[model samples]
Target: MKGQGKRSICVSLVALTFASALAACSSNSSSGTQNGTAGTAAGTTADASKEHRTLTVEVFDRGKPGQPDLNNNFWTKYINDNFGKQFNATVNFVSVPRAQEVDKLNVLMASGQAPDISFTYTQGVVYNYVQQGGLAELDSVLKQYGPTLTKYLGDDVLKYGKFNGKQFSIPGKRTVLAGSNTFIRKDWLDKLGLPVPTTPEQFYDTMVAFKEKNPGNVSGVIPYGFSLQPSNPGLNYIPEAFKPSSLTEEQFATLQPQSIWLTNWNMPGFDKAVQYMNKMYNAGLISPNFATDKDGKLLDADISNGKVGAFQTNWDGPYRTAPGTYANLAKNVPGAQLIPIDPWQNDAGKHPKNVYSPNGMYIIIPKTSKNVDLAIQYLNWMADPKVTLFLQNGQEGVDYNMVNDVPKQTGTTNSGDKMMTVANNLDYDILSNGIELGDQQKNTAAISAGYPGYEKDVENALKVGMVDSYTTYYYSLPNAADAKSNTELKNLSAQMLAKLIVAKPAEVDSLYKTLVQQYMSQGGQAVQDEYIKNYKAQNGK
Candidate 1:
């Protein structure tokens, strides 16, 4: 239940595991990643990179097999040589379990056992620390020591870290912010003589066609891939086209957020959206047991096995090679064509999807830390253009090669320093998310190259996902009601939503009403009301 608002805890795990999924929601992209290396090249502070004795930063133990140690690895050694020795400080990395980072960091900060620099994606963690006055105010330190850092992160991204005007965290800058994209089997469409779906009605008819035609010729064809997890991107977005577009600011603020955790049953068109989904489910247009595929493995497996005709997933998912959904599909089914499409549009004629906020992790320097100055200096150094480039692509011609001026990653290197386990070596470049070329065109080309043959598909997905996309809203103050009841309420939302989706047509409305009623009684109303209060109080602050 950590970080459910904006991008949920599941979304973070999606980034850590199926990085392709992160590509859709990320401005933390690959191209502009190196842009930070130049970091506007403005180190205006008198002693920006001053000498210090020691510095500590937290890194995630991503639990990937054969992955280098988070604390000490080739990348860490490179950092030590390039940045650490120059500052006369030994940079130490403290590893926190990725899946349990928020909980672990809470304990660490409370016990004064945290690193000099740490971060969390969970807003509740930041709120807890701010409430306890355990986080250092970074406003002055950033102005005095992190000019380039501030410029790169910009006002919009940095604002996410401010609470009541106190800058308690440094939000990592993400340059692009696209989100989920839906894909259809181009070959199936051709076989069935159906053009791409345009409206919600057309889209549903298309799914029905996908089922009735048996174009894939599989024993049990899955017209659409789905997962019932609260974090499901399709579950979060595909139906969002049904949300009313003319919501006033206050209503949007109160309801749009935390939709994944609390469910947007109260939203005007949400019930209709769920009812349509129930119709699809009863007709067997979706995976029969989608509820069991919490981690997306089973659904992904279905897609890779060439049984799923159409589906939605994090942008660039099918294009990537890791899980290689597209690759496996190509190998299994000859002439299978999976292409990105923005089919469902609301009455306003827009494909409403959730784009990422232009921020990544909320990095902090705890008040308990003695190395505040050094920590700020270290982070500032990280924002350096050259440093950002190194952290992202490693040595040119070793870790990567220049293709049309883009750094193309060459697999594992002979030396450890140039090698990487995670794609884009995101672990090493904690400050940046995906690749960043100088501009969108270059960025698209760079990302396209990463996907090999599916370059066009990747580009299409990115473009389609961005059309009329709404960036996740960040609250300046945390909702205590949400933080307190989110765990219980999130599970309830997921359970009831599954029932609403799978129930008979006649039961859909009654089930949805029950969901909203039970949700309100079981702490939903408190969360909603407290969130509104916080939103109104912090409206223009």
Candidate 2:
């Protein structure tokens, strides 16, 4: 294979160059193993006599203003001390800003400076790379060097990596697949003598009542705080109830059921959803100037300061982890409480919510990489049970201690922060998507451990068993039309949605129609046609 030849050349070059430089750094060190071969354990040994090749992996920076040195974090050192040394490889961690991932990666690829192993959560980006033939075929590489990874991920999950019957990437396995839901102030509901909302009408009435009677004594409360920013449009689930129960065969063929921006807005009930949002805006039921909350700081502040009555968030977000929204709100408002509610009842009188896809981000090796074999070896090592346990849970004594075979965090004042500083570098874990323990019971228990007080809520969420989007199966495939016009169409759609939400009641209908027409003309139609073709070809529909 091309990767094998490259690996040989790379190893020879590195050995020749580093022979003198690393003369004192022998494989006999404490980190080294007897045979100098990578082990399944967390701390394994590597051949010190062999020169170590440098392999770079990309990680998301997450844009913390003052937190620099993402490339040299504790986790980076941990990997270097353990995995890198064990494989006779010097792993270089490259930090790509989370917000500018696509743009930065595009530039890196163009400049031939992309990391050996890169990943992205956006399927469109993966499709674009595959279409451009910029990614290496991984089937042979996995067979040659990734037996452990193959065994761990299994064929069913690995199918997500196949494009055009060739493996161009590896799909990460997600353990918990629950999506976002609406969380409301339970204390306010009790104070106002109201029941939990199950219908759209009931939800709207509840928000209005929250505005009318401020239960928490906080002035200027946002009844339904939402972020209208392009990236974090928090209102996607609110409008799901308005979606058509079923699509026409042609519409179904043309649309991707999972896409919130592309085909979702084009659905039958979308116009009504926008109209409903506009009504909420007119009534001051939603946050004013929501479009300006680009990073969700305002929403977070509102939730923390007891100024938000209700909002949608991940199932474990509000209450889970330290300094949590639920904890903060509780401190500020003496009796504040939060609980999840499925507020959108569909036409059939059943509450419908989006469920997360079982597969997660794609991990791929660029064709330009010189260390493809090293990258595969690193991922395979990461899939090992001991190594995975360390990366996900942290050092046994310092971060967590096993209780009845389940790891639990030790009670330390800064334990959460300490664990977060090291374990939050999720981009490092390239194999398992979510927290995987290789046991369903243990995996569920591990996930619940993160949320201290919301065990039942988390359990109930897993039981929801909502429907996933149609695009779940097509994530690894490329959509040429989308690659060309997705960004433009996304910006246009966001602007139009923002306008419709705040537009005068009389002007909304006309504006929405105009926006949809513009969207269809400006590449949306092309995208739909391409999706229809791909869907039929893939599903034999």
Worst 10 residues of 1 by lDDT: 21-30
Off by over 4 Å in 2: 1-116, 122-125, 212-214, 248-253, 261-263, 291-294, 320-324, 368-374, 410-425, 452-475, 503-507, 537-541
| TM-scores, all models, native as reference | 0.87, 0.77
RMSD to native for every prediction?
7.2, 8.3
Off by over 4 Å in 1: 1-41, 44-52, 67-72, 230-234, 259-262, 413-418
lDDT tens digits, residues 361-418, model 2?
7788888776777788788888887777766666777667887677787644123322
Cα RMSD for predicted model 2: 8.3
Q: In model 1, how many backbone clashes occur?
A: 17
lDDT of each: 0.72, 0.68
